[model samples]
Structures are given as structure tokens and as C-alpha cells.
Target: MSWNRRSLDRPTRRIALAGALFCGLTSAGCIVIDDAEARDEAEEVREDLRDAADDIAESITDALEEIGEHMSDFAEELGGETLVDQPIHFREFYDFLPERAGNLRRTSREGATGGALGFHMSVAEAEYEGRSGAEVEVSIADIGAMPVIGSEGFVEWLDLSVDEESDRGWARTIEYEGYPAMEEFRRTRGDRGRAEFTWFVESRFVVVLDARDVTIDELHELRDAIDTDALADLRDREGR
Candidate 1:
């Protein structure tokens, strides 16, 4: 009898050899084992091992999927509900801006698409009349599909101070209709000044108004003109 020892592992080879020896001793006459029988036994062992490996792989994959689901649930519980998919209309945000404020006219209007992570965002830009080389640019971004940025979180992130000597802008946190907001102002050389006001609505949408060669009063007016409640509702309803 010829045995292909290399076809099997050490333990399997030993078992096969033992079985063959037992069969030969129990059988009548000179027992003759062919290579085909050895090969068949080796193939069966390989199939069993492959089946076990496949089962283990499937179990691991299921476990990973379960873990991912649990993590997503935990995140939602900690960070509030996530927003849903919805198309944004830039004109809706643009309408929030006054058609005309004093001498500043709505010179140009445009919209752009932007977002981060798995979130969706609508960016609306409106430029106002400029004096000399300065103009006021207002941009409103309606972001969806993100965790809520609560007022407390906003306060922690809004801690910033101004550097007057460096002519750099300063930021101070404020509350607008019960929502956290920030305003910043900076002035460089003659007639070169900038101001910005930003506020988040329902911890989702954000409105930003920036001005060049404009006063803080103008920026305040722009901020006041926006109906934040309506804007917040817009985002909320769309998410639903």
C-alpha cells in the first residue's frame, strides 16, 4: 500500500495511517490500498476545514454588523436625532435677507451646494451695494443630517476674544431669540473694516452676515431682519 503523506496534516496523516493499518489487519489476504482512497480522505478533511472556516467568517461578520448598529443607536441617543435627506431651495434663505437695507441694494444673488460628513447643506450668497472697493456679503447655510449642536456646546466653542492692538476682530457670544449667536468686528487701515454676525438655528441651520467697510449697526440690522424662527421651521419640516 502506498500513502501520500504530504496530502494530509501531521495529526490527520497519523489517523489515516492508523485506519489503513486497522483495515489491512481486519481484512483477508494482503490488503491493498490505492492512492485514490487516501486522496478521497484528504479531500474530505479539507472540505470539513473549509466549511468550519466559512462558518467562523460568517459569525464574525454578523458580530461586526451588530456592533455597528449599536454604536449608531448610542450616537443618536447622545447627540439627538439626525436630519433626513431633503433638497434645499436657496431662494428661501435669500428671501430672509431684506431686499434693500438703507443704501445697500441686493446686487447679486447665487447659491452653492456644500456639506460635510454625511450631511447635506445649502449655501445662499447675496452681495449688497459696496462703497469704493468694499461690499457686504451675506451667506446663509442650511445644513441637515448632523447631530444637534446644543446651546451649551455652542457656548463652549464660542469662547473667543478680540485683539484690539493688532487690529484683529473680536468675537462675543450673544443670544438671539433664545439661540446662541456670535458677532465679530475688525478694522485695518482707513475705510477698510469688516464685521460679521453668525447664529445657529435649531442647532442645525446657520446664518452668516459679513460686511466690508460697514458698521456694526449695519451688521446688526442684517441679523435682525432675518426671521430665525421661520428659517428653523424650514429646516425642521424638511428633515421630517
Candidate 2:
């Protein structure tokens, strides 16, 4: 681990100021002192400052090392082989999506793979349309072995118990199909509105259900339509 410059440097500036003050006092003859004694006092102050700086630096480094190790263990536990095991193709997620969800029919489907910030991920996206051709999209991401893109920012909501309501709509977390999940709905004119359902599956795949002009029940219908078990099954098998 590297030391933070701002932290160490500030103390260093103070040490320099101390040295400068000593020189200014000597030059101005503000205090009479033997040259040898003055030299000994300055050396002691400088040595003390150096020791303090080293101590601070060592403490920070130790803390950072410990944190890095813990994060490494957590990351492996979170995704396991998905983090480093494979060259996963987005195509694996294609068949996982349903052709028909509720009243919506899939209009298009696509997949992509890429890397970013030293991490890789794969994504499968599908667009759905109702009889009225509204905006409905489903995205499934396998963060095992593709470019992170922006998917790295998506995090699992673990052990979060939330149930909130507003005049617009409501949001809550629930164990859907035994998986940690969250669903949010916002009301619009009549029964139409916007909604999203997020499923953090198997600690690897993140599935999102996004739609407009839909009610909360409609969102559940879409969520209920997908076989999330199939999605997790694919990752668990392939990851091993």
C-alpha cells in the first residue's frame, strides 16, 4: 500500500516550519544559545518529526493492507470464478429471457461483452412491447467475465429491509423466488406509470425489469414471467 501524500505532507510542512522558526530565531539573535546546544536541539526535533511521520505512514499502510485482503476475500465469495474463471459470452444469457412476459412481447434482443477498471462483465438486453408498443426493457448482466462498462456500479441490495410509500407510488424489498429483490413503482395518469424490479441472483447475475405505462401488478407479472432459477443455474454450472 502507498501512503497518502496529503496526510504525510501536511506534517512535513509543519516540521519545515519548525526548522524555519529555529533559523529565524538564531539569525535575529532573539535568544542567546551555544551553537552546539542549538544544533543538538534542532537534530532532536527533526528526528522526532521523522519518527512521527514514519509511525503515521506505517499505521495507514497496515490498515490499507488489511482492507485490501478483506475485500479480496469478499469479492471471491461474492462472485467466485465469475470474477476470474472464464471468458463468458453474452450469448449464454440470450435464451434465459422470456419471449413473452405478461402482455408484452419481446421486440428485440441483444448481448455484448467488454472490460473496464480491471474488471470484465457480460450483458444480455431485450426490449419488450405491449399491444400499444410501450417502452419495456429487460437487462440481465453476468459480471463474471466481460468488460465492466458501467455495470460495475450496480450493486446487490443485501439484507436491506425497506418499505416506503409516497403520493407517487411505493417501493419495497422482498425475497422474490427466494432471491434478494427490490421493486419500485411510480404512479402516473390513471393506472399507467413507471416501474422497476431488480433481482440480485446468485451474487453474480443482476437482472433488471424496467417499464413505463405499467402498474405495480403489471411489474409483478413481468417479474413472475422470467425463470430466474434458469439464469442462476446457467451461471453456477458454467462458473464451476
Candidate 3:
């Protein structure tokens, strides 16, 4: 009978030791010992963790959204889209050309489209006075849709080195009615000659006047004849 009592006491002591060990591991005032209460506390902890994760995700999303908005605003301020996407009306530019440049008379006028190349051009032919069969061609090209040509770097590229001895001929920078311009004059041989005046209007459209058998003075006069203020007004209307 004493042996049976000792065996029962040993089993009861082992069970009590296991319960104490579980309580020590949990350290929650032994409340984890109750199955239902422990399940409720675990669910509450899971809910709090989920809420914290959701808040973190929301914060990240908001930050990204704000960054995107700022980038869009910056692009707009640079006139990147407005300058590149606006359609070029060739007629408006054609009208800006004068009926005559000095003694030269306009012989022909034509409009050309570049299609997929994204450009519009107006060409005018003029005959030099007192010079039989001698002609000059003046062309205005709108290359705003082209990224490289319309960019700020284009202005730098126009700053060509002026050297009469070089094959490229004489290239120089000059101001045309307050706008930066490039003038190039080249003579291949004999009396035959070529001259050009190129400039960017409103930092968008590219205007070029190419003349055959025309003097530098005549080209300058032609460049000055263009109505720059009218061109500015046209660009403003389109941007709006």
C-alpha cells in the first residue's frame, strides 16, 4: 500500500513540474495555461501586427505617389511636352516670308511634310535682280517634334567654328532681332556660292534660309524680315 501511494505521488509531482515549466516559458502571469484565453490573446497580437504592416504599406504608397507628382510637375515646367508635341502649321511660317528680299523676287513657294520624321518645311525660290538664271532658295523647317534638334543642346551645336580656310566654310554666331542665330557662307569655285542663316524661334521651331548666288548682306536682310513677335504669339496660343 505505501509503494502504490509513492508511485501516484511521483506521477502527480511530474505533472505539476511540466505545468510550471510551461508557465515560466510563457511569462504571461500563467494566463496562457488556459486554452481559450491563450487563443484570444494570440488573435489580438496577430490583429495588431497586421494593422502595423498595413500602415507601413500605406505610407510607402503615399511617398511614391508624391514623388511621381513632383516629377510630372518638373517635366511640365521644363516645357518638354508642350514644345515637342505641338503640331507645326506650315502656312503661318510661310506667310512670315517676305514677298521680296532686296532686289530678289519670289519665283516659287511650296510646303513640304516630313511624315514619320516629324518635321514641316516651307520652301521659297527667288531670282536675283539683273543676274539671269541665278536663283536662291529659302527654307524654314519646324523640327520641334524631334528631341535632339529641339533640345537645349541644339543651341550649343549651332555654335560652329568660323574658318574660311576649312571645307565647312565660314560659320559664325550672330543675333537676329534679339534671337541667337548662325550664319554660314561658302564658295566652292568661280562665281557659284551658297549662304545660310539658321536660328531657333521661341526655342522650338528651326528657321533656315539657304541662298544660292546671294551675298552675306542680302541674307542678313532676309533674316531680319521675319516677324519674330508674331511667331512668339503663335507658340503661346498653341501652348495654352
**Which candidate has the highest TM-score of all?**
2
Alpha-carbon lDDT, every model:
0.55, 0.59, 0.50
TM-score, structure 3 vs. true: 0.51
Across residues 23-140, which tens digit of lDDT does each residue of candidate 2 receive? Answer: 4444443334579988778766666666665564444334333333433444544543334444256677778777887787887775545433334455566777784435677767
- For model 2, what is the error of residue 152's alpha carbon versus the real structure, in angstroms, after optimal superposition? 16
Highest lDDT against the true fold, candidate? 2
Off by over 4 Å in 2: 1-84, 145-157
lDDT of 3 by residue, 37-156 (tens): 778887676566556545544443343233334334433444333354544655556687778776666654544232223222222222233143335555454544434444454445
TM-score of model 1 vs. true structure: 0.55
- The TM-score values for the models, in the order shown, are 0.55, 0.58, 0.51
**Better candidate by lDDT, 1 or 2:** 2
The CA-based lDDT of model 3 is what?
0.50
**Which parts of model 1 have CA positions greater than 4 angstroms off?**
1-81, 114-117, 148-169, 189-192
The candidates, ranked best first by TM-score, are 2, 1, 3
Q: Write the per-residue lDDT of candidate 1 for residues 1-240, one digit (tens) a residue.
A: 001111112322222233333334334223344799876776666666556545544443343233334334434555644564643655567688777776577776655343333444455666786455556766665545444333243334444433233446566667778776766678765535787677777666767676788766666666677788888777555632
